[model samples]
Target: MPEVFTNELNLFSGQLYMKSMNEYLSVRRFLGLRSADQKDSEPELSGSSTNVMDTETPNLIKFLRVLTMKIRRNCESIDKTHLGRILDHRTLDDSDFANGMDMDM
Candidate 1:
């Protein structure tokens, strides 16, 4: 995991942590580097993620719904293009980037 996300994880709620993780994974997938990762690559964030996603607003990160169910198992297994938000501002569209569309940062 990158320091930008991991550095503040202790202060982050489970939901934010999960979003950061998912976003990191999504970037790796976007770059086609998932297959190149080694077996043990949990760099900074320690412990299991089993209880990290405990959030009151479960829909904040909006995990891709499958059959009306958001997956809780193997959460790292899902690499989705998420539109991360900012305060009163828009974020780059991951879907557009994934589809080879230009983004203006």
Candidate 2:
């Protein structure tokens, strides 16, 4: 039979164990589970659990400016595909911004 080692003996599995532990810590931290020896600093579920709106969508004005800068940076000589992609991103950003603003009222 294989001899079992203690949890503290994470000597064999380094990166994998650390990654898993980080994930566990994140979830437990988010859900207000702290170690027995540590204090719980997270707000209670009633106040912290409420979902909030995402108000940080890509800025359409900034997107347009960046797209224009990229085109100008290339001496107005960008390929059709790159230009198309920029246009598409601009359109999507504008639509997203408008939709988010509509929800403000």
Candidate No. with top TM-score = 2
Q: Which stretches of candidate 1 lie over 4 Å from their true place?
A: 5-96
Task: State the C-alpha lDDT per candidate.
Answer: 0.31, 0.29
Against the correct fold, how does model 2 do in TM-score?
0.21
Candidate 2 residue-wise lDDT, 41-94, digit = tens: 644322221222113113432343354445433434222322233323311123
Total backbone collisions, model 2: 0
- Top of the candidates by lDDT: 1
TM-score per prediction, in order, is: 0.18, 0.21
Model 2 weakest 10-residue run by lDDT: 7-16
Error of 2 at 47 (Å): 16
**TM-score of model number 1:** 0.18
